[model samples]
Target: MENNEILLKPAMSFAVLKILPLIFLALLFLLLAWYLSPFFVFFSIGTLAAGWYRLLYIRKSIYLVTPEVVRISRGIFFKRTDMLEIYRVKDYVITQSFILQLLGLMNLTLKSTDAENPVIWMVGIPESDVIDTIRDYVQEARKHNRIYEIN
Candidate 1:
């Protein structure tokens, strides 16, 4: 956390894809409960709970990019944090699906030398200059550490 310069949080749009279906199902169940049996009310409650869980899970994720390392923190009940040295970053890719493009969000995938999590995906990031900022930091960190990729 030394001089951490940038912090990125996934947009709530990340949960839309996942929760949308659940929401529809919940409404369907509610309609069925209103017209048919009361047991469907329980199903509606369950679907709503699942949607809520997904929202909380997505909301809890955070990404921090520092000059020396990238920190990823995610979890709902049990928090887990991972750090990838900026110098270890080998490559990165930005992907935008049709829905994400419509939402003005993109996913960033980073290939790094970290053994535990070599490929990290940061989803629902806004379409912005974050990639350029990270690239600059990675270059600076590699130069400062005197680290060079062979291939």
Candidate 2:
């Protein structure tokens, strides 16, 4: 296996849920467009396409924690990938809503010194051993990279 193997593929449920309101709006547009001219069909299609693109983008989101780096890949037709060296990782915070707590899911935000992408957000991760494993890997990577603070 690759050393940079994927550590977690987070659930898309959170992303889908987050966009439900927009999806409802899109549905409303479709209904309105149906009563309107056929030209509005194009508008409805555009709305639906945008909504699907959002869902697909969230679905493609992946969180990867290797010994040396943390990576997030997200997007639909246009893909984006962000990587933060583990040694640059300063801290991480895990947040959960009441519903998320009930569902045993949490969102993790990583803070790093990386200039371009200093903050990394990962949602729908199981709040258990995965967090610990990531922490351990960050520590190990810092050690391996000989990263230390003078103070």
Choose the strongest candidate by TM-score: 1
Taking the tens digit of each residue's C-alpha lDDT, what string does model 2 give over 77-115? 678888888778778799999978877788888888889
Model 1: per-residue Cα lDDT over 25-70, one tens digit each: 9999999999999999999999999999889888889999888878
Candidate 1 achieves a global lDDT of 0.89
Q: Candidate 2, which ten residues in sequence have the lowest lDDT sum? A: 1-10
Please identify model 2 stretches exceeding 4 Å from their true place. Answer: 1-6, 33-42
> Could you tell me the lDDT of residue 73 within candidate 1?
98
Error of 2 at 12 (Å): 3.0
In candidate 1, how many Å is residue 69 off?
Answer: 1.0
Model 1 error, position 48 (Å): 0.5
